[model samples]
Target: MKKRKVSVLGSTGSIGRQTLDVLSAFKEDFEVVGLAAGSNVQLLIEQIKEHKPRFVSVKDTELAQELKSTLSDHSIEIFCNDVGLEFISSSACDIVVNGLVGSMGLKPTISALSHGKRVAFANKETLVVAGGLIKNLLKRNKGEIIPLDSEHVAIHQCISGARESEIKRIILTASGGPFRTWKEQDIQKATKEEALKHPTWVMGPKITIDSATLMNKGLEIIEAMVLFELPVGKIDVFIHPQSIVHSAVEFVDGNIIAQLGATDMRLPVQYSLFYPQRRELPFNLFCDLLSVGKLEFEAPDFNKFPCLKLAYHAAKEGKSYPIVLNAANEIAVDMFLKEEIKFGDIPKIISSTMENHKPSEPSSLDEITELDARIRREVSERAKTSKI
Candidate 1:
C-alpha cells in the first residue's frame, strides 16, 4: 500500500508541532508532501531539514527568501503570501492537516476540499467563518473533513456508526482554563501571563488565551454545530477541570456514551488522520483509577465568561454574525495579549463589534474574506477609542 501523503499548514504552532510529532512516530505510514508556516523561519528551517517536504510556504517574501537561502542545496518549491498557502493546499496530497490560526485558514481548507483531498481540520475558525461554504465545497468535490480538536474528535467518536437521530444532546467538556476558580473581581485585572497559563493542555498563545476566556469552548460549540449538522440548542458545554473526558453524547433513550482520554492532542490528530482504525502508541495511557479518583463537572459562569455567551448568540443568529464574532475575538485577543485591553474587555470588544455591524449573506469565499478584513479593521479602530 502507498503511504498517505500529508501537508501541514502552520507547521510551527502547537498543533502543527504535535502533528509533526505524530507523523514522526508513524513516518512509515505517512509522507510529508508540503508544509506552511508564518514568520517562524528559524523553526521552519529545522522542520524543513527533518521533513524535507517538496513544497513549503512562509508569511512573506523576506522569510521565503531566507528559507530558500538556508536550503540552497535542495530544489524545493517555496511560496509567500496567501497564494503560497493556496498552492500548498491545492497539492495532490492524500490529506491536509490545517492547523493554522484564525481566518487565514479558511482558504487553504477550501482549496484542499475543492480539490477533493481529505482534510483533518484543527482550524475551527474556518468553519466558524464559512461553514456553509465548506459544506458546499464538500458536496462539489466529494471530500470529507476529520475533526482535530480533542472535544470535537471525542464527540465524533461517540457519534460514529450511530444514527444521528439517536443523539439527544452532546456535552462539550472544558478545562475552565487557568482561572476556573479565580475570584470574579480578579478576572478583570488578569494579566497576559495569567491567561496564557492553560490548566491542562499546552497550546499556542492565541488559543491559550481563547481557552482562558472560554471563547475556545464557545468556538468549539459553533464548530460542532457545523460539523455534526446538529442544531445549536442540542449542544451544551460543561466545565470539566481534569480534561479527562473530552466530550459526551446523550441518547434519546437516556443512555450516555463518552470518549475518555488524556489531554495529549496527538491522540485526536492521529485518530482523525486514520479514522475507523486505531493505531498503537506508547504515550498517554488510560487514566489510572487510583490516581484519578473523582471527576467533576460544573456549569460555565456566563456572567464571568461572556465571550461564550456571545459565541452562542453568534451561532444562533446565523448569517454573518458568527463571522464577525470570530474576527472580532481574534483581534480582541491580540489586543488583550498586548495589554491594549482589560481581560474582561474581550467579550465587550466582540459584542460591540457584532452590535455595530450588519450581517450579510456571504455566499463566496471572497465575500467572507472581505467581511473579515472589514470586521478586523473596525475592531482595531474601536479598540483605539475603547475606554477600557
Candidate 2:
C-alpha cells in the first residue's frame, strides 16, 4: 500500500496539531511532505523533528532563519510568508490540510487546487470570502475539497449517496458558546475572558470569540451555502449545547439523516484525511449516546446575537457582502479580544462596515484580496475613531 503524501498549513494551530495527531496514529498509511506554521517556531521545530517533512514554511524570514539555525538536518527546504505558503500548497503532496485562520488561507487553497491537490479544508473564511471563485476552480480542476469542519463534515457524511434533488435543507448545530443562556442585557457587557470560554470544543481565540457571539455558526451558514450549493433560505442553525449531533440533512420525504460523534475534532480530521475510505484509528475515539442521555436543540435567537443575522444577510446578498462581513467581523473580533471594543460592538462594527460599502463582485483572487485588506483597514480605523 502506498502512503498518501500530505501537507499541513497552519501546523501549530489547534486544527493543525490535531491533524498531525491523526497522521501520527496512521503513520504507515500517510507521509508528511510539507508543513506551514506561524511564529510558534518551537512547536514547529518539534513537529519537523518528529514528522521529518521535506519542506516547511514560517510567517517570515526571521522565523525562517531561527528555524533553520536550530535544525540539525540542513537538507530540509525552508520558505517564508505568503509565497512560502503557496509553495508548500503546490508542492509534491496528494492532500493539503488547510487550517490557516483568516483570508490568508484563500490563495493557498487556490494554489493547491491549481496544482491539482486535494484540500482538507478547516478554513471557513476561504469559502466565506471567495466561495464563487473556489467553486469555479473546482469545476475546472481535478482538485477536491473534503471539509474538516464538524458541521460541514457531518453534512457531507449525511448527504453521501443522496441525490441533490432529494435534499430539503441543512441543519447546522451550534454549541451556543458561553453566552447561550445569558440575558441579553448581561450579554452586551461580556468580557474577553467570558467570551473565550466556549462551552464545547476548544478552539483558537478568534473562533472561540466568534462562537461566543454566534458568529462562528454564522460563518458556517455562508460556508454551507457555498459547499452544499444550497440557498440561504434552505439552511438553518440550531443551538445544540450538547454538540453530539454535528449536523443533519432533511430529505424531501420528511426523513432526516444526521452524523453524531463526540466533540472531538480528530474525528472530522480523520474523516477528511482518509476520505472515500474509512480507516480504523487504532485507538478508541467513539461516541456513546447511551451515556449522553439526551440531546437538546433550539432555534438560534437572531435578535440577541445579531452577528448571525448579519451572516445570513451576507449570504443572501451574495456578492462582496460576505467578504465585507467576514473582514469586518475579523477586525471586530480582534478588537474585542484586545479589550478595545465591547462584546456587542462586534455586530455593530460589522453592520457599520457593511452599510458603508458599495457592493461589487470580485471576479479574481487579487480583487478579493484588495477588497478584504481595504475593509480591514476601514473597520480598524472606524473602530479606533469610535465611528462604529
Candidate 3:
C-alpha cells in the first residue's frame, strides 16, 4: 500500500508531538512531508531529523536560520513566520494535521483546504472563529476536516453512518478540569499552578487553563456547532469526571450511540489520521471496562463556569460574537498563564469584550483575522487595567 503523505502544523505542540508518535507507530502507513512550529525550534529540529519531512517552518527568521545551521540535510526547504505556515499548509501533502493552538491556526487551515488537502483538525479555534468561512471553503474545495478532538471524534464515529434527520442531540463530555469540586470562592482565587493540574489529560498551558475555567469545553461547544452543523439547542455538555465516554449522539428514536475509550489522546489522533479506514495498532491502547468502575455524568454548572454559558450565548448569536469570544478567551487565558490575571478574570474579559462588540458576519478570512487581532488588542488592554 502507498503511504499517505502528511504535514504536521504546530509540530512541537502537545497535539503535534502526539501526531508524530502516531506516525512513528505506523510508519509504513504514512509519510511525513512537512512540519511547522512556533518557538520550539529544538524539538522541531529533532522531529525533522526523525521524520525527515522535506519542508519545515519555524516562528521567525532567526529561528529558521538556527534550524538551518543545525540540520545536516541541505536539501530540506525551510520557511518562517505566518508565510511559512501558509506555505507548509499548501504544500504537496494528502493530509495536514493542524495541531496549532489558537486563532493562528485559521489561515493555515484555509490554505490547506484551498489546496484540497484533508485536515486532521486539532485546532478548535479555527472553527470557533470562522466556521461559516470554513464550511464555505469545504463546499468550494475538495478538502475535508476530520476532527482530532476526543469529544468531536467520538461524535464523528457515532454519527458515521447515521442520517442527519435520525440524530436528536449531540452529547459532549468534559473531564471538568482540576477545579471541578472547588467552591466558587476558592476557584476565583485559583493559582496558575492549581489551574494547570488537569485531572485526566495533560495538555498545553493555554488549554489546561481553559479546561480549569471550563472555557475549553465551552469552545468545543461552538466547535461542535460548526463541525456537526447543529444548532446550539441540539448540543449538550455533561461533566463526566472519568472521561471514559468521550461523547455520544442520542437518536430521534431515543437510542444513544456513544464512543468509549481510554484517556489517551492517540486514540483520537490515530482515528482522525486514518479516518474511514480503521487500522489495528500493534500496541495496546484499548480501554478495559472491567478495571474501571462506574462511569458518572452530571450537568455543567453555568453559574460556576460562566465561560461555558458565554460560549453557548455566542453560538446562539452566531455572527462575529464567536470570533470575539475566542479572541478574548485566548488573550485572557494567556494572561492567566503569565500570572497577569486571576483565573476568574478569564470569563470576565470575554464577557466584557463581547458586550462591547457589535455582531456582524465576517465576509472573508481577512475580515475575520482583522477582527480577531483587534479584539485581542482591546481585551489585553482592558485586562491590564482591570476594566473588565
Per-residue alpha-carbon lDDT of candidate 1 for residues 1-388, written as tens digits (9 for 90 to 100): 5899999999999999999999988888999989999999989888988998999999999988888888864678999989999899988698999999998999888889888888999999999999999988776756789999999999998887666688899999999999889887899789999998898999999999999999999899899998998989999999999999999999999989998987889999899888878888756656665687888999999988889999999999999999999999999999988898889888888888888888788879889999999989888886787632
Q: Between which residue pairs do clashes occur in model 2?
A: none
Could you tell me how far off, in angstroms, the CA of residue 80 lies in candidate 3 after the best superposition? 0.4
Cα error of candidate 1 at position 145, Å: 0.1
Reference-based lDDT, each prediction: 0.90, 0.93, 0.91
TM-score of each: 0.97, 0.99, 0.98
Q: Can you give the lDDT of residue 380 in candidate 1? A: 88
The deviation in Å at residue 219 for candidate 1 is: 0.5
Give me candidate 3's TM-score against the actual structure: 0.98
Report backbone clashes per prediction. Answer: 0, 0, 0
| Native-referenced Cα lDDT, model 2 | 0.93
How many clashing residue pairs, candidate 2? 0
Candidate 3 Cα errors over 4 Å, as ranges: none
Q: lDDT tens digits, residues 1-388, model 3?
A: 8999999999899999999999999999999999999999888888998999999999999999999999999999999999999999999899999999999999899999999999999999999999999999988865999999999999998987776788899999999999889898899999999998999999988889889989888899989888888888989999999999999999999999999999988999999999888889755888899888889999999888999999999988888999999999989888888889888888888898989999888869889989998998898787767798
Reference-based TM-score, model 2: 0.99
Ranking by TM-score: 2, 3, 1
